[model samples]
Target: MATFIPPGSSNDGADIDLLGKELGLSSGQLREQLNALYARLRLLLTTDELGAWRNESLALFRFSASSSAKATEEYFRVAPRVLDILPPHLFLKWVKRGKALCHDSPGIAAAYFRASPQALATLPERQFNVWLAMGPGLYKRNSESMELAAHFLDAAPALLQVLNLAQLERLLLFLNRLTETDCSLAIRCLDSAYRVFHALEDDERSLFLSIALALVRLKPMASVTFFKQGIDSLAGVTSTQRLRFLTLLAKIAAYNSRHALSFLTDCSHALSGMDRNLHPRLINQCETVLAISAIAGIEFLNNSPAVLASIGPAGLERWYREGLRILRKDEKDGLAYFRLEFPEDGTLERLLVRVELDHVRGVLLMYGEALGGSEIEIRSSDSLADWSLGTIDPGTPATDGTTIFLPSSIDRFDSAEENFTWYKVAVTHQSGHIEFGTFNFCFESKAALFSDSRQLLSADGHGLSDMDRFLGLFDDRRLAADIFSLVEDVRIDYLVQHRYAGIRSGYRFIVQESVWKRPSPVYLPLREAFLEIVIRFSLNGELPFVPEALRGPTDTALRLLQQLRSPEARVEDSAEVAIRLYDLASIIPNTRLPQRDWNAGGSEQARSNRVDTSYRTSDGGDVTIEPGAEVPYQAPTDVDFRGNSNPDMLNIQPTPKDGSDRGTLSPLSSDIGEVQLNSMMQGENLQSGQYTADL
Candidate 1:
């Protein structure tokens, strides 16, 4: 008669018969073991899936022990996800490696296969095996209950999004490798790892985890910190900026692991307000601290954030790098100075450079408000990122019509007053766009100063907006846009010059500076060089030399723009000027000028940067562009000012959450009353009982 086969597996009786011979088992015993394996899986898998299961369960062949089948059988019932953990393809290999594991602890391999998948989703077969072996040992000495331990295992896949399969394995290995193997760090990893990943790019995640794991081993006792505040602080800092925190962690780990988290938390708090660009400097500062000694490093890191914000990055670097002097004189003295415990005999104050955002905010705001003809909110240029307005360009000021955005600080200038003047120029230019309506031009719109004789290349009556119609004419949208900008800015600068007397000095200074730094006319491509000359001519700017080929259009454009100096010139007139300029630019090709010996004229461009603009003196004096004492500063080229300016804006205020009316001031109070004081005695009660008044 044929041997009776099991209900689930299609493996013939021959396979079981061969397995019995290898393990030195009788037919009856082997059949019993196979029957037990069949029973556990039959409860969970379909008949089709059971075929795959039978192939994997053959790992039982590697084990001759009587209890191997039984341990797996019991564990399989609780672990419905075991198949997910050990895919049928990898089961045979995993089982072979399980020999030593099964020998030391009879049921551990099955217990892991069952318990591990319940917390986290099925990992790649290889990653599963690492966790399979390590899972049982993680909480071996910890107070974590089985369910709580499983809770941490469940978080693996979410973190896996930020970490690769290999990185995930390394993280687990670090915990398992720790002599005490703090399970709480694993729990913290589950809690904040997602957030830490949020702040890091995928490539950066590996390095961050590497440093974290290194900290665990270097100061194994630091798990208290790893569990409490460390991971949360890690989330607040970016991956690139983590070097500072890492070095600071190392110092604290060396000094006393107890202080690491506090120092890390303090540093994160300080970093929260800073720009990410400054992080590299912070790292360099931390290294300098470490170079001094453990105490000195920790102290410097602890106070670094505030010092950085106070002194600025350059100043802070100078301060930290200078600490080597005190450290050389007396390391203890330097440590106290960095910690701010001692002021270092005025050395700390000397190193400090107090620069506040509010320093020039009010002045720039008022300057913009006066020119913008509205109460404009002055914000940092970084705020421009929030606007959906087209390309954002640095160095050019932008306005949303309601707010003028400038660079966050003006360290580019020496004094606060000088910085305010610089900021004033940025605000005034952006505000001028709003006041003069540089963005108001429409296509096919008639210009008041010059007739629009350019033929419409497209259907004139199509439903295109003026902007669309105007922009459609040019093959190069960027070039057309820039030429229009140069013309409009010249008109706006003209208006601001005549209207706001207070800002003319800065306005003239910036315009002059731009002309001074303008790229040599000969170096620019032919058409671009012509556009450059026309722009300089519009600015009343002096150029080193104008190409002979461009002289005709340049002369005509200059003559037409001079009409704008008339009191009758309006925003409409400027639009006409833009149209004329655009016409001149249309004929020019976009290519470099072919010339011999280009370098010989470099010094000439430098000498002729400022052209004699017929400037109208502040007190109704004769216009003159006569040379004055040289104040050297560079401004972006005219192409930069035009081509690189941010898009014309739209109102970008966020939708009000409650949609409350913005028509009126919020009510301050509905009731108004004053309480009369009882001056009879020091301890007199006013209302609890009757009190006598002084007669």
Candidate 2:
């Protein structure tokens, strides 16, 4: 063995001057070059000066090309500089040189061996791992450090068997540190390591696995087992943080249900029997799980008894009740009523309730059928009453009936005190002679003669006041004044003249068929009768009436009535006047004489006093007219007494034997004929002696 020794082998106490022998260069020269390169690279790295470092790396590469055996040495020397410059493209050049020179050149290999570890650490982890796998020269040159390196194990794990406990610990520390920065990078590194590990012999791979597992047990941070520790550590965070963890857990669970469910169970168990303060946080997590389960179409969640139990029956009931209440309120406020025509069947059963008040009043049981051919029959507990209906000739068919009751016979019961009576009315429809049917029931009340003024003036309330207010808007002074006058006159006629006894005076105007003949339908007058009545009554407080001095006021009233009898006058003005008069009559006090004595003549004393009185008697003096038992009178001839009367002109005449005045001729004798005288003369000639008594 001593006869021929390998020159590059480590020999105990042998100093063969290997660098000089192998490279044909002094050791000092190699050391100087290496030192200079190292110095330049260190400066480049520290200062991050790329310009100077590029020139220096190019100069070193030029120096290595001159020596044939120096390629590996040059590669090992330039790699650190290249790493410092971070020229990713040059990694392959250095790797090729490292591979070529790594075999059979001890000094070159030793040079590479000394620099590769530092160069590898300096290079980016990705490129460095690639170089280690492709460049066996770098690996063999730094075989000891490579054996100790986990990063190198990514390329050749078979050599991991050579690493001792301390080397394995160093490998684990580097891997753990690399992973600490980025788990994805660690996964890539571990994946590469796994491929290399599989390439190893079974025994060698087993030894590496044992060391790795032992290192993982001692310090889990270097191993994948630390992921569980990380999850457990995150357990003591806030609800929002917990929610984030749960979301991540759910994503993880999507990929692997077994792992995710295990994690969730652990979290759930940790949450239970712990602080009650975590209830809200735990519940939020549960809700998040439920939402995720729903979105994922997880069948387990839908079929799970736990999820159904969480929502509970009471909560569902509460939600339903709240929805119902909202609906009810909306219905109550949104209800509305409207007016509509009667259908062909003449029924409104399906119409809305509140919107039909006016229609109900006009054609239903609340208001009596005052106008129209529609009848209303009222059925009550006591009795039923039917009201006969009539309508204005030119008016709309009073098929629309209001249901109000009127007594069949309004009996005036003589009671000392007031009496109240009520009657029921049922609204029904009638066509021709047939009764349609009762629709509704209503009641009407009657009161006895009011003894108090308050009862009579109670009309101040109700729609009467509103009607008066409405009439005030018109500015027609003449019409307003006429209305007032007419109302006042009607009131005087009705109350004072003793006309229209026992009848409730009200104003009503109708359009007769004769007035609006062209269209063959009644037309509303230019003005409404009700408005006219309001205006007239408001102006005068009574209807117009004639006076007794002018052949009695009725004759004068009749003359005015006749003047208004024309179609235009009756419809336009008279109708208005009539309505106002009626309204006024209703309000004004009756000053007329009692109906019982209204037509009686004057007393006997009054008649005699009228005959005895002189026509020209002075106000306070009595006239002395001497009474002869039968006084004779004389007619004045053409004395022209039509002129100023003279008290001194007294022409007296004697009385005749018949006591009748001849000058005061009878109106009957003025028409007697001479034939009567001839008949009387012939009879007188025959009975001259019989004419003893002048017959």
Count clashes in each candidate, considering only residues at least 3 apart in sequence or on different chains: 3, 31
| Ten residues in sequence with the least summed lDDT for candidate 2 | 416-425
lDDT of 1: 0.54
Q: Give the Cα error of residue 305 in candidate 1, in Å.
A: 6.7
Pairs in steric clash, model 1: 119-154, 443-466, 542-611
TM-score for each of the candidates: 0.45, 0.17
Which lDDT tens digits does candidate 2 get at residues 1-695?
11333323464123223322433444465655544554444333322343333444344444444544454355545555555544434544454444444443334533553455444554454555453433232233343333323234333323334433344344445355544345444444454554444343444433434433443444434334323233343344343344444454445444444444444444444444344343343444334443433222122221122322332222222222332343345432211100111224322222111111221222222112221233333222112111122211211112222222222221111110100011101121111101211111001112122122223323333443222322332343234434433432232223311221211211111111111111100111112222222322222232221111111222223333334333222112332443333343222222222233222233222222222112222233443222323212111111110111111111112232357533431222223234432332222212223222221
- Model 1: per-residue Cα lDDT at residue 242: 68
Q: Which residue runs of candidate 1 sit more than 4 Å off their true CA positions? A: 1-70, 74-89, 96-100, 115-162, 180-205, 235-262, 273-301, 304-337, 341-695
Residue-level lDDT of model 1, residues 430-534, one tens digit each, is: 777777765555554565666554343545638755555655666766666666666666777777667655566665655664565455567566566767766
Among these predicted structures, which one has the highest TM-score? 1
